[model samples]
Target: MGPGRIAGVVTVPELAEGDRLTVDGVDLRVRVSARRRRFALTIEPDATVTLHVPDGRPAPDAEEFVRAHRTWLVTKRAIRERTRPVNPAKRLVEGEVFRYLGRTYRLTVADDVPSAGRVRLVAGRLVMSRRAAADPARGREALVDWYSRVGYAWSVGRLQPWAARMSAAEPALEVRDLGGRWGTYEPGTGDRGVGLMCLGWPLFQLPMRLVDYVIAHELAHVRIPGHRGDFWRLLRRALPEYVACRAELDELGRRLWMGEIWWGG
Candidate 1:
C-alpha cells in the first residue's frame, strides 16, 4: 500500500514443498514443484484434497489460498466423489458391461471363468473367472493385466512411425495404471539415452483411432516435453483432429473408468 495504493498487488498462484494439513476438519495435501508456474487446488474422486504450489511461492500463501477456496473444494469433492467408481470391482457384477478396444462386452462372472488366460470372449461376452465370483479385486487385476499386455502390442505399432520419422530413438513402452494421467513421456539422457513412456492401461478400452491420438501425443513429447509452441505444431501435423479425439476420449474415459457401464453384450 505504498506507491499505488488503489492498484497495489499483482500475484500469481504457484507451490514450493508438499505437506498435509487439516483445515476446518478437512484434510489437505500440499505438493510443490518447480516446473509448476501457478497454484492449483483440486479434490480427487476419492475426496482427497491436493494443493499444487509452484517452487517460488510461499508456504503461507498456499495455506491462505486453501482456506479461501475451502467452500469450492468441498463442493467439488462432493460432486466428484459422488460419481467416483468404487474401489476395485465394487461396481462389477454378473452380466455387467465393459468396453475394450472400442467393442462392448458383457461380464459373465462364474467360479470357473478361467484365469489361465485372458478374460474369455465367448459369444460377445467377457467371461470373468472370479474364482467363486467373490474376489472382484483379483478379477479387476487380471483384466487390467490382460489389457496392458494387449496395449503394449498395439502401442508399439502405433508409435513406431513417429519414432522413425523424428529420427529419435523409439521410447520403451510401459503399460500400467498411471493414476489420472493418460500417458507420460520420460525424456532420454536419464535412462541411458532410451526414452520411457508410461501409458495408462485403461486407455485400451477406447477405439484404436483415439488410442493413436494419445500415442501421437506422447511421441510428440519425445522432442518437445512441454505442451507449448512446437508441441502443438508437431501434434497438428500428426493428428489434425486431435482436439475431437481428446473430447471423445474424455467422455469415453469417464464411463470406462467406472469399469462396468457399457450396454452392448
Candidate 2:
C-alpha cells in the first residue's frame, strides 16, 4: 500500500496543533516552526516522528521532504519496535524489586494504617502501607506520591552545596515526575529573579551518585548555557569522573528512563 495522509496537512504557521503525515505506511507527526532555517526531523525516544520545517513553507514541500526521508524513518521505526520492552507484570506487586540509591529491595505491601501511608526502604523490602495489597493501581499511585516527596526533599539537599560550590545563585528547585531524561537547568532573566531547576522523579529511582551527576550537570549550565567545551570543562571540574558516570547513566537508561509511568509536572 502507498503512504497515506495521517491527518489533514497543516498550512498556516499559527495553527497550534501538529499535523500528521504518512510515508511508506509509517506515521509521522509534522510540526511547522517559522523560526527554523531548514528541514529537521527526529524520531523521538518513544518512536514518534517530529519534523520541523521552516516557517511559511507550504504543505507540498513538507510532504516532499518527508518522502525524501521515508527510508530513514522506516528503518528507525523498525528498530524502536524491535527493541521496545513488553509491559512487565505490574511492578507494584508484593514481590517485585526496586532500587533506591543503588540498593535493591523487595516490595512489601503492608496494610498497617499507623504508618500513615508512608513508604520506606526498610530491612530488605521497600515497604508501604495501604488498604489494598492486591490493587496494583493503588499501589503504584501510592508509590509515585511517596517518590515525589522524597525526591524533592533529597534533591534540594544535594543542590544546595553544588550551588554554593559553583557560586551559582540558588534558583527555585522543583522535583516531580517529569518522566524524561535526568533533569533540566534554566537560567533566569533578571537580577532578583532566581532561575528554576527541575529534577525528574525517575532520576531519584537510580543511585544517588548518578543523581548528583545530573544535578551537577544542570548546575554547570548556569555558568555555561550551552553544551560546548566550556560547559564540559566546568562539569569536569566538579566531577572528575563525570565522563564515566555519563556512560553508566546511558547503560541504565533503558531499565529506568523508558518506563511508561505518568510523566507528571
Candidate 3:
C-alpha cells in the first residue's frame, strides 16, 4: 500500500491523449495537437469542455491557462445553458416529417415493396422499407445515409462556384457526420496535394442559403486557416451579407436533429 496506489495497484500520472482534469469545478478534456501553437478552449455541442494544448506543453501550464480563463468559461457556460436547444427525438413512424434543403417530406414505410432498397425520395416522399422502419437504428442510419448522398450531390455544384468567387482552389469535398462541427477544412498534406472539406450530414437539413454559408466558410479556410480578421475580410469579399448569414446559422443550427431516435415503448 502506497500514497498513490490502491490495493497494491500503482497509479502512474502522465499527460496523454484523452486525459481529463477538473479545475475550478469545471471538467476539461485534454487534447494535445502538434498543429496548435498555443492553448485554446472549445465548448462542444454537448457542453463538454475541451482544452487544446500544444505539443510538449506541461500539465501545470494547461491548468494555469484554464485558471486564467475561468471567468470567460463561466460566462460562456451560463450563456449556453440559457440558449441550449430542446430538439425533440424523432420516431420511426409513418408520415413523420423530415426536411432537406428547406423542403419538407413525409416518411413512407413501404411494406408492399418487394425489396428493402436504400432509402429514396420518390414522388416527393422519403420512402423507407418496412424492415428498416421496424428497427429504430436501421431507420436512422438509412435516413442519415440518404442525407449524406443527397448533400454530396448538391454540394458538388455549389463548391466550384464558391471556390471561383473566393479565388480558392476547389478542394476535395465529403458529406458525413462531423461531430460538433457543421463543416471542417483540412489543409493538404504532402501525401495529398489538395485540401479536403467535410460537411456534416445534419447541415443538409438547413436551408440552401445556410448550406452555402457553410460552404463559403470552409472555402475561406482554404485561404486563411483561422477565423482571424483576414479570414472575415476574405469571406466578406465573397459574401457581402455573410454577417447576417452567420448570425442566422447560430440561431437556426441549434434546432437541427442530431440523430436522436425515439424508442417507442
In order, candidate lDDTs are: 0.72, 0.69, 0.87
Which regions of candidate 1 are displaced past 4 Å?
A: 1-17, 20-94, 109-118, 122-124, 130-132, 165-168, 189-191, 258-265
Sequence-dependent TM-score of model 2: 0.68
Q: Once model 3 is optimally superposed onto the true structure by TM-score, how far is the C-alpha of residue 44 displaced, in angstroms?
A: 1.6
What's the distance in Å from true for residue 70, model 3?
A: 2.3
Q: Which stretches of candidate 3 lie over 4 Å from their true place?
A: 1-15, 112-117
What is candidate 2's local distance difference test score? 0.69
The RMSD of every model to the true structure, in order and in angstroms, is 8.1, 6.6, 4.1
Error of 3 at 58 (Å): 1.0
Clash count, candidate 2 = 1
Candidate 2: regions farther than 4 A off: 1-43, 49-89, 115-117, 130-132, 189-192, 257-265
lDDT of 1 by residue, 180-203 (tens): 667888776644997898899888
List, residue by residue over 1-265, the lDDT tens digit for candidate 3: 1125678986544346788878878999988877778888888766779998888776777878999999899888777777676676888788988889988999998887555756899999999999988888888898899999999999999999999999998999999999768999988889777999999999999999999999999999999876789999999999999999988887788888878889967
Query: What tens digits encode model 2's per-residue C-alpha lDDT throughout 109-206?
Result: 77774664566767778787655344455656666666777888888888889988876777788876664446877677667577788887767768
> Model 2: which residue pairs collide?
34-55
lDDT of 3 at 65: 92
On a 0 to 1 TM-score scale, where does candidate 3 land against the true structure? 0.89
